[model samples]
Target: MSARQRNAAFQAFSWLPHDLRNDNAAVFAVRIKDLGAGVQTCLQLIETSELEREHIRFDGPPAEGDAADVPLLSVTDTSILLRLAITIAGVISEQAEQFCQASEDRLVKARSAATSTGVDHE
Candidate 1:
């Protein structure tokens, strides 16, 4: 994913409820660069509804691993958390869009001033 996407994810994750956020702060505080990786590995089961219903199918007994290492949250609870994370991400994306537009406006004004001042290209 793009830096913007990861940043949005991190921002969203940070906006969760205090108790839950604190409980999972390590995962919630994941670095911007690690959002995509973390999501794929740690939260893959929480994929979009379409993907979950269409692509995910279980046919055999579950494999055993380090269950103790995993969080004990139920699917409903996990969905709520993921929803909050995505909402925050959307906010971040909107803010970035605004910032980019403002930056472009400033650049345009700066270029106009430079041209009007008889600045020459090298």
Candidate 2:
């Protein structure tokens, strides 16, 4: 992803609840270098909350009556989270592609070396 796109992804994190922020005290705590880790953290939080029968809570669009503690996602929040997830997935896919290409390059080089050394190339 382009730097600008990555930056926008990080900014979308602001839509998340303060409790869900990577670091509640820091503004924009989610960094480009920690994209995968940030996404992982968010996913874990969601999974854990779901398992406990709790929806991720937010401040606004107050829930009706006794549902405030486990408020469901507002339409805006759902859209924002979905978009953020897609952006994160794109970045992760790019990183995986790069890793696979690098691995292939290394294997080709190793095979070349083995052939030259007459070491029974795999």
TM-score of each: 0.42, 0.45
- Span of 10 residues, lowest total lDDT, candidate 2: 24-33
lDDT of 1 by residue, 37-106 (tens): 5445435555544354433343233357623323345567668767766765665566556656867997
Question: Model 2, stretches more than 4 Å misplaced?
Answer: 1-72
Residue-by-residue lDDT tens digits, candidate 2, 45-96 = 5555554343333334445674545424544555566577678978877866
Name the weakest run of 10 consecutive residues (lDDT summed) in model 1.
53-62
**lDDT scores of the candidates, listed in order:** 0.54, 0.59
In model 1, the Cα lDDT at residue 74 comes to: 52
The lDDT, on a scale of 0 to 1, for candidate 2 is 0.59
Model 1 scores a C-alpha lDDT of 0.54
